[model samples]
Target: MELRQLAVFVAVAEELSFTRAAARLSVVQSAVSAAVRTLERELGAELLIRSTHHVALSDAGRVLLPEARATLAAAQEARHAVEQQRGGLRGTIHLGILQVLRDHPVSAARVIAALHARHPGIAVEPRQAGSAVMADDVRHGRLDAAYLALPSQQAGLTLHGLSEEPMVFVCPPDHPLAGRAALTLADVAGEPFVDTPEHWGTRIFSDLAYSAAGLAREIRYEIGDLGGVAAFVQSGLGVAILPPGMIDPVASVTTVPLTDAPLFRISLAVPAGRPTGAVTRRLVETALELRDRTPTPAG
Candidate 1:
């Protein structure tokens, strides 16, 4: 009938003696007897058998022991959950964002704004990183979470795919194939290519696409700076393969669809096999909400 009564019943059931149960609960024996009598009357069943020499459970007591224990455990868990909520999601979330996502700054801002408005106690520190390093940073504790372009499997991280951004080929307007609707990686295999460094997230997918096509890309320039890749292609330095949304709109550079380009899958990656902190969980939820509401590609 009541949590205290159930707790008292459990103690008596386990100990099999009111005197022992009272001692275990640090209460007087008569008080324990009175509590059990009240519980039995409420349940309309006798719960214990008592004789001068021994104490034993009646049928009702045996049947209710496990259920009583369960009720107490559930009540304790409920209290813990409330206490945790009262504590607030108050902490710093060491977050990392992919350099390419910087192109869609509004989505990033919206996620942070929603998180802060709902849980003002959470502080977000966002830093830019190449997709290749985002997963490793999160797994190694250098970051709490990150928006990453993850490979199919990351050993020590959990990846939640948010959006798939298509890749395109960027070439100077005068390039022979610039006006084409779409072309495969093989078509541009021999062209002078401006690409990201080998360690970049974009480079990983590009390399896999080229490898699948059995094409050896002629990388004329490998840019370390994220902005330099588009700059090089726009200046007639070389053709580049990149997410169309990530590239700044340039009249001099024509974005041709790539038939075989791999779609960049953006995901929220967190360390695997650990309890996520309250603030980190809130960030993940907000990011998911934003991801679902935003369009995949920029107009």
Candidate 2:
């Protein structure tokens, strides 16, 4: 019923622990519990199933979570609009960034710096995670927006294409496939490959590529960081398929063009069909501008 109550409920639903939610909101645990109880009484429905050790969203809670998020976003947008009219935007933008963008031209640091320079009153909180997890976070209202790689279309999120780079084949210099002028998925189908874990954007893209080509490849090494893939390949543990920017030139690995390479597409994802706050909009614009200024990586 009340905005404060809804805020408390959202925090508890997200953290799934009264103590953690109270800590996050900087409020006492009793206050958090009181707010949730008031909300439940007003709604005439149980929102969360609480136990001593765990809390899970009930069916009604799951149904109300997205609506609560939308309502909160709308309220924030209204406040931000009024704040902008008065002077400057003042709010926090929870941003999700990809782990593999450290070496890329559209660096997250650059984007954040630009946002800060433009809107000094706004605060940007950045969290690094794999693209899939970031996307999910954005959809669930945990993150205001995210810079991530999109392997495919995601529901409940709007993706603004930032950059697209073709994947390259990486292997040791002396490897058999290293001498090839170019390679295809079929060419590397039988070779041992090194890649990120299944949930990572790179792995999902690679898997989709192989699946589309009706091919299956063996993954001998699964590295978490894109930077580490080169090391695995340099040691002759296995080969890799990654965007050109991800391959370390200084490493002992060789990068060959992929004739049928899958494109690694980066995008800015935000929740679809909802109003975004001024801070979130400004951050999105900053990211897009930075992406435009940075030259695309050559295949």
Could you say which candidate leads in TM-score?
2
Model 1 is weakest, by summed lDDT over 10 consecutive residues, at 100-109
> Tens digit of lDDT per residue, candidate 1, span 1-299?
89999989988876677887887678999989999999999999999999897888899999987788678757755654675679755667889876752547325567888898987877899988777776766764557798886566879789877777678888988889988999988888889988887767788878888888777978889997657887888788998888765676644588898877788777888878545665677799988877777667632
Across residues 1-299, which tens digit of lDDT does each residue of candidate 2 receive?
A: 88999999998988788997898788999999999999999999999998889999999999998798788878988898898889888899888987753457777778888888878889889898888888878875678899888764789899988788999888899999778898888988899988998878888889999999999899988988877888888888899998876666678888888888999988889888667777888988988888888877743
Model 1: residues >4 Å from true position, as ranges? 1-87, 101-106
Candidate 2 to truth, TM: 0.86
lDDT of 1 at 217: 79
Residue 200's lDDT in candidate 1? 77
lDDT at 19, model 2? 91
Compared with the true structure, model 1 gives a TM-score of 0.68
Which residue pairs does candidate 2 place in steric collision? none
Candidate 1 local Cα displacement, residue 178, angstroms: 0.6
**What is the C-alpha local distance difference test score of candidate 1?**
0.78
Single out the weakest 10-residue window by summed lDDT for candidate 2: 99-108
